[model samples]
Target: MLLTDTHTHQYYETDPIKREELMQRCLDNGISRLFLPNVDSASIELVMSQVKVYPQYCFAMLGLHPCDVKENWQDELNTINAAIPQHKIYAIGEIGIDLYWDKTTLDNQVKAFKTQINWAKKLKLPIVIHCRDAFEEVYKVLLEEQDEDLRGIFHCFTGTLEQAQKVIELGFYLGIGGVVTYKNSGLDKIVQQIDLKHIVLETDSPYLTPVPYRGKKNESSYLLYVAEKVADLHQTSVENVAAITTENSKIVFGV
Candidate 1:
């Protein structure tokens, strides 16, 4: 089964020696593509290094994460904007409003989110969103900015069935991860309700490790666990899940 991890931060591993080791492990496990999303200025070089080291297996996206927005958010955006013409970014992403950590930054977060969305539209690239405790805010922004040109993935989606359907209606894909394996997460119901075409598998590693590896540091190889769970929930085979989601990711990233 050829699987694609739509999201992972293996690049954040400062240890070069160990980073390559785990990345090779991903390749061995049939993870043909790994998409890395930029977190902030500090993470640019680190994440870009993954694409440099393994050009075939790794791809990147450029954008300022919502949590990283601050008083100096504009400066941060300027720095990333300058790098745009120089690098091949798959999408504008890991960007959206994150109100879970600090509600006070909502205004700045919204500004940053819209700014990046504009950049994506101008570049004709899809976006990869990172939303937390701000679905209403996210939906509002998406409604305003969405057009036939606007498309992307809603990474780490853990919303209700209604929200899942709404995202599909808006022409977006839902990124499912380890949270689906959690008991009582209630995401299985959402999964059953949504078609496999609108769903994609992700690890969000080194976070959201699936069961049997829960609470442990996640890796791209762990994406198989998520695929397995998704297959089980949809009453399908693992191979079928992998094939379909891989194609879905290709559509989202335009790879």
Candidate 2:
């Protein structure tokens, strides 16, 4: 029962003992692969350090997050690009537009998102998007840039069924996370209708913990809860959910 956590911040634990414990917990639960998305320039070292320690389990992505877009976004991009010196990047991601926190930076976020989208295409890598309260904006950028070379996952997706179908049409996958397990989130209805081929699972940990563990700090091991919820929605077994979504994650990351 090998499960894949396609998005998580496992490097944030900091403490060596806690970090090892977290890794072990993931292994114990049969989750051997974890994709770490770049949050910003500051997280580059932390993420790479974890990748260094667990090269077999942790994969990395590169990009500026929407919330991190500020006046000096160009400099941040340069820093992220510089880190590509010799490292393997699974995707150009956790990047996209987010209007929930600060609508003031919407323009900068869009600009950054486009820049990263182009970067992903140029590198022939998939992108992991972080869309929040701005699906239309993200969709517009994707529409303008959609091409044979364009492909990626809409990470932490919490959108409408129409949007999900559109994303599939755009050659991307919907990354389902803890929100699907929330009561009345309505994501279960969509999950039931959406085929497993276009769906992937993510933890986005240290955040978005599932119902039983909601309001608590999330971890990669808790990814099982989200998988269980997906199984319930699909009326299948947790093992089946793990097998199918792990395959979907591999399809996106090509690992």
Candidate 3:
């Protein structure tokens, strides 16, 4: 069973000496591919470099994260726009509202999110959403700005069943991650009702590490933990989870 980690910052702080070792560990554990989501202009080069180093195993997505939204948001978007043709980006992602951290730039975040959505539509690429504590706000913008041709995954989705349905109705797959393995997480409840084909696997590493690895650094190798937890939730096998989610990923990422 070849598993795909559709969303992970494997390139985040990736060191030359340990990069191969870390990625090999993931490969050995069934993770055949890892997609790195861009955060801003600052991290694009590092992400691009990592993709070059392991072109066969690594794929990169370009976008300015909502948290990075600020006064020069347009300038940041311009950088992402220019980078699009340079790299074969898998998607435009890790982009959307992040009201959990800061609200000072809420308006700017919406504008940036909408603008980026337009770019994604124009480029004919899927998107990876990063909604947090702003589902309603995110939904509002998605309803208003998302083009009919646009589609993708909602990364790190921890919302209610209703919210999941809403995203699904909008034509996005739920990006299940480490949060699914949490003891008190309600994601498992909502996920039990959703079709496996509408789900995709992710790590969002080096963050949201699953149980047993919670409070520790996350990696692509730990994706098995999340897959196992989801399988258990669905009363299925890890291989089944991997197969279905990998297929779901291919639909969204085309890779």
Candidate 4:
């Protein structure tokens, strides 16, 4: 089976010596596809450059991250828009409310999210949302903007069954990642109850590495561990889990 890591940040090549090696390892381990989500204006060039280096294996998503929202959020969105034509952005992504870190920027985060949502609607593209400790807040905005044309993935989804049902109702898929493998993670329970059709697999690599490698730096190669956990939760085979989740990803991102 060709495992696809629907979300990862292979672009963060801070360590040159390790970057190429890790990518090769991922390839050898069957982690063939990667979708890189852009944070903001400053890293667009870097992210796109990384995508260019491995065009066939890596895909890109363009959007202003919730944390990147600030006083000049509009200018940053403008910057992302200006460069969209140069590359094929699979989705408008990694965008949503993040109240866990800084509450002071809540207003700006909401504004930026809504603005990007509008852009996704106008462009006829799916979205990749990064919501952290702001479920109700994110749901509020999503409900207001959601329509038949709006579709996306709730990247790194860590919510209850009710929330999952709500997002599915809004025509969005849940992005299940490394967090589900954690011994105490509530996501395992959530996934066991929800159907696989509403889910997609991701690593959020260089971040949420699964168990066995938890607390260590994550890589796209570790996506298999996440998939294994999901398969176990659903009491299904890994190949079935991968096939269904990969199809769910293509449905949302139109990849």
Candidate 4: Cα lDDT at 15: 60
Model 3: residues with Cα > 4 Å off, grouped in runs = none
Enumerate residue pairs that collide in model 4: none
TM-score of each: 0.98, 0.98, 0.98, 0.96
Off by over 4 Å in 4: 14-17
Clashing pairs in 3: none
Error of 3 at 52 (Å): 0.8
Worst 10 residues of 3 by lDDT: 141-150
**What are the per-residue Cα lDDT tens digits for candidate 4 across 1-255?**
777888888788856668788889888877878999989988888778778778878899999999888888889999998888888988998899999889999988998899889888998999899999999999999888978778989999988899999999999889999989998988899999989998988999889989989989999999989889999998998989888988887777777
Better of 1 and 2 by lDDT: 2
Clashes of each: 0, 0, 0, 0
User: Taking the tens digit of each residue's C-alpha lDDT, what string does model 1 give over 66-114?
Assistant: 9899889999999998988889999997899998998998988988999
Writing each residue's lDDT as its tens digit, candidate 2 over 184-234 gives: 899888889999889889999999998898999999998988988899888
Model 3 over residues 31-81: C-alpha lDDT tens digits? 988999989998999899889998998899999999999888899999888
In model 1, the runs with Cα more than 4 Å from the true position are none
